[model samples]
Target chain A: MTRQFLRHGWTAGLLAILALLFVFTKIIQPDFGTSGLDSLSRAMLPFAFATAAMAVVVIAGGIDLSVASMMAVAGVTAAVLMDGAGDGMTAVAVVIVLLVGLTMGAINGALIVITRVPDIVVTLAMLYVWEGVALLILNGPGGSATPWLRELIVGPFIVPWLPRSLVFLAVCLVAVWVPLKRSKLGLSIYAIGSNDLAAYRSGVSVGRTRIAAYAVCGLFAAIGGLTLTMSTGNGEPIPGPYLMASVAAVVLGGVVLGGGKGALLGPIIAVIILRLVRMDLTLLSVDPNVTTIVEGTIMVVVVMFGGVLAYRGRHK
Target chain B: MTSETTMFKSVGRFIGNNPLVPLLILLLVLVGVLEFMRPGIVNERWIGNTIKFAIPLAMLAACQTLTMLTGGIDLSAAVAATISAFVMATQVPIVGVPLAICIGLIPAIMIGMVNGFGVAVCRVHPLIMTLGTGLIATGCLQVYQRFVIASGSVIPDGLAWLGTGRTWGLPNALILFVPIAILIIWAQRRTGFGRLLYALGSNETASRISGVRSWQVFLALYMLSGLIAGVTGLLYVGLIKAPSLSLVNPLLLPSVAAAVIGGTSIFGGRGGYSGTILGALILTVLGTLLTLLQMPEGLRRILFGLIILTVTTTYIRLTEQSR
Candidate 1:
C-alpha cells in the first residue's frame, strides 16, 4: 500500500542521502577513497551482519546493545584460538567464535526473559561484561590470526570485485532473510516482540524465540568482529563503546527501539547515514572528539523523529 | 486481636520491611572490601580527597537523580558544568570570584529550564531533548572557549582558597556537599514539591488526574539539576582551575553510575539522595584504589567497566530475586 510506503519514506530518504554523501566524499577526499571505501566496506560488513541480527531482535521488540562487545569477544576468541593452534585449527576457531556468540546471546535472552529487566539494562551490562572478558582474554590489543587462515578468510580476491567481508555479509543477509521471511520461527519472533503475552496466549514459545533472537544477535556480532580484525589487521579494544553506537544506528535506521517496527533496510541505511556523517565531519576537518557530540546528537534526533512519527501514526 | 498485640505485630513488620537497611548493609560490605583492598584507604587524607573528588559528581548526581525521579534524565548536566567552568574561567578575575561563581550558575539553570520545557511542555522524550540541550551546551562551551582554556591560569586567591580550604580534615567541596545533601534530603522528605515529584514519577496520569501541576514540578526539578551542575562546574574550577572540554563526556556516565548504583531505580521513584551519595563514594573510592594500585589506563578502564557491569548485574539479579 502507498500508506506502507509512506510509513517507510524516512528510511528511503536517508538511504538516498547516504548514497549522495558517499559519492560526495569520493569527490572531495579522493586520496583516501580506495582505502576509505575498503575500510567502510570492511567495517560496514560486520555491522551489516549486526544490523541483520539486530533486525530480528528488533522485530521481536528487543534491542541488543551487546553486539559490538560480543563481536569483540568473538574476534578476540577467534584470534586467540588461531594464535594457539596450527594451520589446521582455523576452521575449529571459527566454529568456536560462532558458538561463543550464541552462548553469550542466549545468556542475554535468558536474563531478559527470567528477570524481566528492561532490555537496555540487560544489553548494557552485557556490553560491559563481554568487553571486560575480551580485555581479560586479549590482555591488551592485537591478537594474531594464522597467516594462511587470514589469507583465505580476509585476503583480497581477483575473480570478483567484492571483498570476502562483503561476501560474508551478503551470505549472512541471505541466510537471515530467507529463514526470516519463509519460516515459522521468524513469525514467532515478530509475535513475541510485538506482544509477549499475546504470543504466549497464542502458543508461541516466547522464551525460546527471545533466546534464539539473542543468539542470532551474538552470532552476527562475531561475524562483525572477524570482519573488523581482517580489515584493521589488528584488534583494537577501543571499539567497545561502539556497541551502543550500533544500537543507535539500528534505532536511527528505522528499527523501533521497543522491538517490533521497522525493516532491515532501515538500519542498513542508518549505518550508511552515520558513516556518511562521520565522513562529512572528516571532510569538514572537525575535531574527531566533536564527532561524539555530533553522533550522539544525530542519534537522539533520529530516535526523536521516529518517536514522533510513531506517535502521530498511532494517533492519526 | 487486642490493640496492643496488633501494634507489636506492626512494629515487628516495620523492623523487617525497610529496603534501605539491606541496601545500606550491602554498601557497607562493598566499602569494607575496598578498604581491605587498600590498607588505610579510609585514612584521613584519602577520605578527605575522595569525598572532595566526589563532590562534583555527587552534586551532579543529586540533580540528575531528581530528574530521573521525575521519570526523565538530565543529560545536560555535564555540558552545564562545562558552561559554568567556562564562565568561571573567563569571568572570575573580571568580576570578583563570588560574583563570577554566581554568574556561572545562571546558564546551567537556564539550560535545565530548557530541558524541562522541552520534555514537559514540548512532549519530547527526555533522552532526545536533553541530548539536544547537551549538544547546545557543548557547542556553547566549545565556541566560547575556542576548544580549550589554558591550564593553571590565575583565579582569585580567595576562591582558590575555598577550593583548597578544609574544615575538620574535609576539603571544602566535601564539606560543602554535606549541607547541600542535608538540604536536598530535607527538601525531598519534607517538602510539597518533593512529594509532587514522587507522585508524578509513580504515575503521571494519576498525578495529572489528581490536579498536581506536573509540568511546573518537572520544570523545577530539571532547573534544579542545572543549578547543581553549575555548582559542580564552579567546584571543578576551584579543583582544576581550568575548563577542559575533555572532562564533560567522561563525567556523564560516572554521574549516572553513581546515582543508579546507589539504589536509584532507572525507572524513577523509590529512591533518595543518600543512596546517590553512597554510590558516589563507592565509585570515587574505586577510582582511588585503581590509581593507588598503579594500574595502567587500559587496565583501569577494563576494571571500571567490569565493576560497573558487575554491580549493575548484581543489582538486577537482586531486584529480580526480590520480586
Candidate 2:
C-alpha cells in the first residue's frame, strides 16, 4: 500500500492542490458556493474535452494542431442541426455531428499516411481548412439548440450545484476511455508513440493505431463542441481558445511531448488549476494584461520546477 | 502514344532528380497564370515587390528550417517576433530608432535564451518550451504595452527604406537580405554549428556518443532562431508600416508551411535554406494568385489547405519514386 501510494504520489498532490485552490477561491469571494463551482465546471468543459482530445493524440506519438478547428466545426454543425429541432432530433443531430468529426479525423489520418508528410505540417494546414469550413457552414455566429437540449447539457443535474455536463464527462470517462485505455489498440498507441519502427517490427500496425487515436480525438472534440454550444446557447465558428492551451495542459499533465507516457487525471487537474488561477486573477481585480502574464509565468515556473525535481530524482 | 508516354516519364525523371525544380516551376506557373489573368502584371517593379514581401517570410522560415533540422521547433518565434516589433515600435519615441530597435531585440533574445534553457537544461520538449516561452513573451509584451502605448511610434528611416525602397529596379531589401541569405545557406553547409544541427536532429544518441555537446548546440541554435525571428519582426513592421499586437503571428503558420513546401521535413535531419527561400517566394506568389482570383475568404482558406496537402504529398511521392 505504501509503495502504491508513493508510485502515485503526484496524483494525490495535484488533487490536493486543486482542493487548496478551491479553498483559496472561497476565501476571497465569500459568495462562492455551489453556484460558483457549477459555473466553473461548465466553463472548463470545452477545454477539458479538448485537453482529452489532445492527450490521446500526444500519447499516440502525434500532435493534432487541428483539434480546436475540429471542435469549432462540430459545434457549428451541431448548432445548425439541433436548432429549432423537434423531439428526438437533437439526439440524431448529435450522432451526425459525431460522425462528421470522425470523418474529419479519418481524413486527417489518411492524408498523413498517404502523403507521408509530418503530422505537424498536415494538421497545421488542416487547422486553417477546418476553420474555414466552420465559417462556410455558418456565415456568422447566430445558431442555437433547443431549450431542453441546452438544459440537458449545461443545466443542473440531480442537485442544483452539480452540472449535467460534468456528470456527462465522468460517465464518458468510465464508459469509453477506461475500456479503450486497456484495449490492444490503446497499448499499440503507446508502443508506436514510444518507438514506431520497433512497434512496427513487433507487429503493431503503426498507421492504423495512429489513425484510431486521432479518430478518438475527433469524437471527444465533437463532444466538447456540443457542450460549448449548449452552454453558451449559441455557436460561433471561431476556434475555441483551447487550441494551444490544450497542448500546454497536456504537457503539464506529465505527458512527454515526444510521446508514450502520461495520464488523463494530470491534465484534468492542470486544466482546473489553470482555470482557477485565471478565476483568482479576475476575483483579485488584476489587470487583464497582468493576468496573461501570471498565467504564462505559472506554466513556465511549474514545468521548470518539475524538470528540477525529475533531474534530482534521476541523480538520486 | 508510346512516344508521348516515354517523354512524360523522362520529364518526371528530370523533375524528380532536381528537387527544387517543382517549386520553381510552380512559382513560374503561378506568376504566369497571374499574368494571363491580367496582362502586364508581371513587370520588373511587381517582381521586386513580391521579392520584398518574400524576404521577411524567408527569414522566419529560416528559423523553422534550422530548428526543425535539429528535431525541434520554435513555436514561440511568432510571438517573440511580435513582442520585439511591438516593443521597438513603442520605444522609438523615447530611445530613438536604432537604440529602440536594439532594445526591441533584447526581449526576443531573452525569450530565446529561456526557450533554449528549458529545452536544453530542463529537457522540456522544444515544442512545449517554445510555446510556453512564446506565451510568456506575449504576456510580457502586454504589460510593457501599458507604459509605452502613449508614446507615438516612429518607423526607423533605414528599415522603411530597406523594406520598401527599390534600388536600380531591385528591392532595396536585397542589400541586407543578400548577406543574410548567403550567410544562412553558406553556414548551413560549411559551418560547424550547421553540421551539428543536422547531426543532433538526425540522431541525438549517436551525436552524443560522438562527443558532441547537444545542449550547447540547442542553446546556440534557439538563440540564433530568436535573433532571426526578431530581425524578421523589425523588417515586417517596416513593411506594413503598422505595428499591431499580432504583427507577425499571422505569418507563423505560413512560415512553417513555406518550410515544409520547400522540402524541409518537419521530422528533421534533411532540408536546406535554399529550398526554404524558394518556398517563401512560391508562397508569396501563391498569395498573389489567390487575391487575384478574388475568391470568398472561406473558399480561399480551404483552397490553401488543399493546395498545401496536395503539393506536399505529390512532392514527397515524386521524390521518393525517383529514389
**Residue lDDT tens for model 1, A1-316:** 8987788787877878887887778677877544465556665666676676777688888877677778887877777777657867877887888888889889889978876666755676566567667876776676777766555445345644446655556677777667765788878877887788999999998988998888877777777777666555556554554554566667677766555667677787787677767767877798765766687677665665666666677768
Error (Å) of candidate 2 at residue B26 is 2.0
lDDT of 2 by residue, A1-316 (tens): 9898865676687788889998899899989977677777888888899999899889988899999999999999999988788869988998899899888888888788777888988898899899889988887896887787777656678888777877877786567689888999989989998999999999999888888888988888888888888888888888877888998888777776768888688887888888888888899999877878887777787787778787788879
* CA lDDT of every candidate: 0.73, 0.86
Worst lDDT run of 10 residues, candidate 2 chain A, spans A168-177
* Best model per TM-score: 2
lDDT of 2 by residue, B130-165 (tens): 888888788778787778777978888888888888
Q: Score residue A198 of candidate 2 by CA lDDT.
A: 96
Candidates, DockQ: 0.24, 0.65
Query: How well does candidate 1 score on lDDT at residue B40?
Result: 68
Off by over 4 Å in 2: A1-3, A308-316, B1-18
Shift in Å, residue B15, candidate 2: 6.3
